[model samples]
Target: MEKIHYRGFWRSLNQAWRGLHYVWKTEGHMQFHAFAGVLVLAGAWWFRLARWEWLLLFYAIGSVFLSEVLNTAVELVVDLVQPNFHPLAGMAKDVAAGAVLVTVIQAVIIGIGLFWLPMWRWIGG
Candidate 1:
């Protein structure tokens, strides 16, 4: 195999942005996650989360986003390789989806833990 010349850092960054744009445009789940992530960050600001709380919240958000992007990539690859209905391809897609679901659930748990008490107190008070 021939060695490929390295592109500049800016070109690599541009490619990454293109991938993110593709996901945002093509994946409804990604759109939903982006909206929800914005809301969560806004809530963290509104609630004035502590340093550690902010760290945890950001970590959870990043985890879910990363999972979603990877899942989308997996689905796209599976579709490309096996456009026809095949059991193994279906299983691969399902597993990728499941990974997204698990990450979303964990993020929800983290959000609830971070916000519930503060919200309750704010509402009650």
Candidate 2:
């Protein structure tokens, strides 16, 4: 195989493009999420949420995308190695999915904590 030159830069760009495509298309939940994330940021900016709140939002988005990419990698590796149905391979995929789920849940909790009360007050609820 020919060696890739400027591989670090190329690799970063490739990964970024893949992630953009993945978030934009492949992940069903991710589309809604990206939208919601945008809305949250807009609200935060409008409301002038604290720096820590913005930090938490950044972490939330990072966690979801990172977990998703890791999960995709796990699934791909499992398929490449097994190439057929196998209990262990299934377990590997399940575990990866679980990791994404865990991140999503944590992000949701943090999001609620960060946004919900302020939203409630804004609505006078």
Candidate 3:
């Protein structure tokens, strides 16, 4: 195993940002998630979501984003270790992607549940 270095806090944050930048640049899924997140946030603002609702929405969105980043990391590491196509490597990537799909589905359900009544009331008014 390679030795790990302990970087300062600011350096750590910068490195994290760099990884996010790379994902944003290379991954279309990340871009779509970002756009969807923005739309959810906008809806929250428009509806004046309750504190609990805000927290739930944040958790859902954060989980999706976290899963996406982790999935990307898993894919990168798998590719690095196994440059050629392998069944196990493909399986690993598929599992990671499945995690992102699960989170996205959860987020969508949460969004619909929280927004449904408010949206209907707004429109009905």
Candidate 4:
């Protein structure tokens, strides 16, 4: 295996941006997650969430984003290495997708917990 040379800080940042751009360009699910996250942010603003609530919301959103990015990385690496249909490769992709699903589910639950009371109060007034 060849050792990778360490690039400067700016170069590392550029590479990270490139990875994000590629994923955002190619993955519909990532776009959907981003859209949902935006909505969550808007909801938090409308509700005027407490500082702790805002922190939790941000954590939840970040978790989803991280999981989705990791899933994409796994899928890309698996495809590159395998390049052909194999049961194990399929399983790898499926598990990665499952991870994203779990993240989304938890995020949704956190959103509900944080918003339910505020939403009801706003609606009642």
How far in Å is the alpha carbon of 72 misplaced in model 3? 0.4
Best by TM-score: 4
lDDT of 1 by residue, 22-63 (tens): 988999988888899999999999999999999998899889
lDDT for model 4, please. Answer: 0.93
| Residue-wise C-alpha lDDT for candidate 3, range 49-122, written one tens digit per residue | 99999999999999999999999999999999999999999999999999999999999999999999999999
Model 2, span 39-80: residue lDDT tens: 878988988899999999999988887888788878878999
Model 4: number of backbone collisions: 0
| Tens digit per residue, CA lDDT, model 4, 84-108 | 9999999999999999999999999
lDDT of 3 at 60: 95
The residue ranges of model 3 lying beyond 4 angstroms of the native Cα positions read 1-7
Q: What are the models' TM-scores?
A: 0.89, 0.80, 0.90, 0.91
- Candidate 1 clash pair list: none
Q: Number of the top candidate by lDDT?
A: 3
Deviation of model 2 at 58, angstroms: 0.6
Descending-lDDT candidate ranking: 3, 4, 1, 2
What is candidate 4's CA lDDT for residue 105?
95
Q: How large an RMSD does model 4 have?
A: 4.2
Worst 10 residues of 4 by lDDT: 2-11
How many clashing residue pairs, candidate 3? 0
